[model samples]
Target: MKKKIIVAPLNWGLGHASRCVPIINALIKDNFTPIIASDGSSLEFLKQEFPYLETLHLPSYNIKYGKNLKKNLFLQLPTILRAIKEERKIIELFITKNSTVSGIISDNRFGVRSSIIPSIYITHQINILSGLTTFFTSRIHQNIIKKFDECWIPDNSNSEFSGKLSTSSRKLNQKFIGALSRFKREELEQSIAVLIILSGPEPNRTFLEEKLISAFKNDKRNVVFVLGKIEAVQKSWVINNCTFYNFLLSEELEHKINSSKVILCRSGYSSILDLAVLGKKVFFIPTKNQPEQEYLANYLEDTKLAPFSEVANFTSEKLKEVKFYKGLQVAKVEFDVALFSLFHSKRKL
Candidate 1:
């Protein structure tokens, strides 16, 4: 019988779940039965991708963000903590019910570790940027991370793709697992001038969608806007010269991205990795008040990978300044070695 490995991703946005595609593929290739656990759109997406694999509906933080960055996060604190507690209980219950479980791979879900089984945590943010909550939050975050047997960073260790975001000031035993992207490198003919991808929690997602539509409504260039609303019925319509889509599957999304001359999207790490893999010129619009997206946008600009603008200041001129960014040179050999090592070490089939 194949060893069962539980794969769980945080339900923040599609980014966390999207990055897990490659990891799940790797796990399956090694002859392990991968079980997915998530909730909301993330769960729906995984189920669509791997119809044959068993999936469980884990509790979600169900975080909602508003225009007021500080107030939104402050309001969600209690709920976030509750979700963490629930995640811990759910993990323990699942492990107890399944005696064949071999290991757990958690993608940014803090409480999804097991005491009896080996657990690995995956994240790109190790050192939270210095801010008002930096002193307290970073320490607490590190403590949670230390519980896992190993922490896997999805970026090159030597030439860090995340700048200071992934760099740890304190010593940490982490494997640089390379950039995990669902889209692979392929040559597709460009047909559209721009492809705008909207993601993250809302009203921010809705806010961005409206903003982008208003910004480019009159432009004659061929543009496509992906609403990123997976639950909505898939629909498409053309307004002026732009085409709008409710959502696209992995292959369809990849084709659309490759077919576009330029891309407009958030500065989320997963999106960044996908753009890096495609090596496309992009204009990044950071979500209002989200520090991680802000940091990533600035980092990309600093590294000459992409130019970013704040949502309030976004304009057509920003797109003109975008230059091609050579994507991160991931150490594939290192990633494969680390991944294979994990599968071979415990509960060998």
Candidate 2:
């Protein structure tokens, strides 16, 4: 019988879920039965990608970020804690019912681990940068991660891509698995001058959408906007030489990205990896008051990887300043090798 592995990702945005694609594929290729568990659009996305695999609808945190994100986060702390407690119960019940489950891989879902099984926690944010709570949250985050058998970071081990985000203080059990992007590099003729990808939790996603639309309304450059709404039916329309897509499949998204001259998107790490893989120039607009996004945008700019501007100050001049980003230089290896190494090492014990 094949070993069963439960794969869960946080539903804050599609970033966590999107990054898991490479991991899931690796698990399946190794003849492990990978079961996916997530909430909302993340679950829907995984289901659409792997219809052959079993999936469960885990409870959502149902958390929302307001215009003032720091205040919103502070207000929602109690609710978030309650959801985490509920998630622990759900994990307990699922594991008890599913006797075949051998291990767990949680992508930033804190309560999905079990003491009885080998559990791995995956996250790129080792040093969380939330205002005021930065130090406190980092301690708490590391404590929770310690409960897992191993912590897997998705950036280069050399700390070239993530900088302090993934490389601050290395814990003994943490492993850097290098950047994991579902899309591979492909050479294609450029058709769109700019490709805008909108993602993240509610209000912010909508806010960015409106901002980008208004900014590009009068521009003559050929633009393609991907709304990143997976729950809605796929739709498209063209106006003023700009094309808009409700969502696209992985293949379509990869193709469109390759065919674009530049990308405009949030500074989410997953999106950054995808752009890096394609070697595309990017102009990032960090989501308002989300310190992680703000930190990443600034890090990229400081590292000379990409140029970024705040949503309020985004303009054509700023877009023109985006230069080609030379991606991380890491030794390439098979995607499955990193995942398999963990399981193989454990089996030898």
Candidate 3:
């Protein structure tokens, strides 16, 4: 009988769901039955993309951001625990229904994946994001990884092009998947210029879009704005040389990213992975109070893989830097080891 795998993705943001696209495709190619367990919004998206896959509703450990880190941490703890409990129950029930479930791969949903089957947890941050120094973050993260069958990081381990942001490692049973990006190069590259990918949970995404539109009103560069599907209600507006697309599918967005000279986007992992694989320069503006994005943006800036500007200070000068760093290129797909080997033995039912 064919192996059955279930992907339990966290619905905190679309990044979790988006990053799994390639993994799901790989599973489909390998002929593994891949079931998706996610919340309403993520399930809805997966339903559109893979209607054939079985899906179950799962709870999300949503974050509550405050102006300061301490306040945000305190506010979110309870919600996270509640979500973990809810997710545990859901996964237990799911495994009960699908006794053929061979393995579970979790994209940041710890509780659900831990509850059933041989579970693999995928997370770049192994330790808690806060209260940990750089010296011990990797060590702590590795300790956490011990709980799962395996852990996967979506980044290149090579130093030449990786920058500090994606080079972190956890030795045992941990794999680097070489930055899973939805964008793939197809046509010849063009230079119509700067493409800005606007995404993330709402209010912040809208806020950033408005800020960019305001700042670049008089700029003479070709700009493509992807407002995301959630923002479909937004009316299209042309400002100087910019063309705004309300929403873009993976293929269309890939074309825009390739055609553009530079990309301006939020510093989410999935977005960073896409830019990294394409070797495109990016001006990342991470969401406010979002520590993960902030860390990646800072790391990118420090390592010189990409440049970033705070939403408060995003300007034409920052936009100009994208052109200078266009020379840097990283080899894509350098590390794509098979995932099946991570387990002691493939459990076929």
Highest TM-score: give the candidate number: 2
Say which prediction, candidate 2 or candidate 3, comes out ahead on TM-score: 2
Off by over 4 Å in 2: 170-172, 324-332, 336-338, 341-349
Relative to the true structure, how large is the alpha-carbon lDDT of every model?
A: 0.82, 0.83, 0.70
In the range 238-306, model 3's lDDT, one tens digit per residue, is: 767988877665676677777877788888877777776776768889887777788777777776677
Can you write out model 1's per-residue Cα lDDT over 187-255, one digit (the tens) per residue?
788888999999988788998899899999988898999988886467899899999998887989999
TM-score (C-alpha) between model 1 and the true structure: 0.93
Q: What's each prediction's TM-score?
A: 0.93, 0.94, 0.85
Q: For candidate 3, which ten residues in a row score worst on lDDT?
A: 159-168
lDDT of 3: 0.70
Supply the TM-score for candidate 2. 0.94
Residues 161-194, candidate 2, lDDT per residue (tens digit)? 6777776564638888877888877789998999
Model 1: residue 189 alpha-carbon error in angstroms: 1.5
